[model samples]
Target: MSLMEISCIFPVTDIKKTACFYVSKLGYKAVEYLECKEAHICLYRDKTEIILLQAQTKNIFPNRELYGYGYDAYLYTDDQEKLEKEFLEKGVKIVKPLNVTDYKNKEFVIEDIDGRWIAFGLKIKD
Candidate 1:
């Protein structure tokens, strides 16, 4: 099968807050918005996209865990310092500070409102 794109569906407690956090703070663009049976919003950054679904049930997908113990996604950026500063200025909660690592890149961690950890990194070029 040919790979195309990756999309993650997240259960949000409040759609507006989630959208605002992503669009206003995280710098993602809203690609789509729908209000049908349930409110749905799609936020995108470059090729990466995430769909936020507002379900009727209080516990959406109760059987399954949304995010694992660690980070759910890793976002690569060319300027880690700038991104970190922007996020800090916006008052976004930083789970971890930006630091250089021997293994891969300069990276940091942040958590979404829903408690999903996103690892932001800048690739170390030789």
Candidate 2:
């Protein structure tokens, strides 16, 4: 068996607010399932999907906060420049601009409403 797709799950203090950020800033469609046993919001954009779960605590601890250096999520994309430009035009906070990493990945990072750093890039093949 082979894996088909993967979705990022984030625990957010306010599901509606977090979902709004993704929907407005990131241009993702949000579907609320607050009536479900596990209340959550599903964000969709292209082939990407992020599930926002209602957090028990008000504060969110992103990976970089606990690990010192790490991204909450790394999404692979074909057109880095275009995506970066689109995000910038949308008023999204780009914590890191488009740049080639030491590992040879053309990537850029954005700071989400929950302070999560998400990197979007594609590996460069020489």
Q: On residues 71-92, what C-alpha lDDT tens digit does candidate 1 reach at each position? A: 6777787888898899999888
Instruction: Write model 2 residue lDDT over 20-114, tens digit each, in one string.
Output: 99998988999989999999999999999999999999799999889898999999999999999999999999999999999999999999999
Clashes of 1: 0
Best by lDDT: 2
Taking all chains together, each candidate's TM-score versus the true structure is: 0.77, 0.98
For model 2, the stretches where C-alpha displacement exceeds 4 angstroms are none
lDDT on C-alpha atoms for all candidate structures? 0.79, 0.95
Residue pairs in steric clash, candidate 1?
none
- Candidate 2: 10-residue stretch with minimal lDDT: 58-67
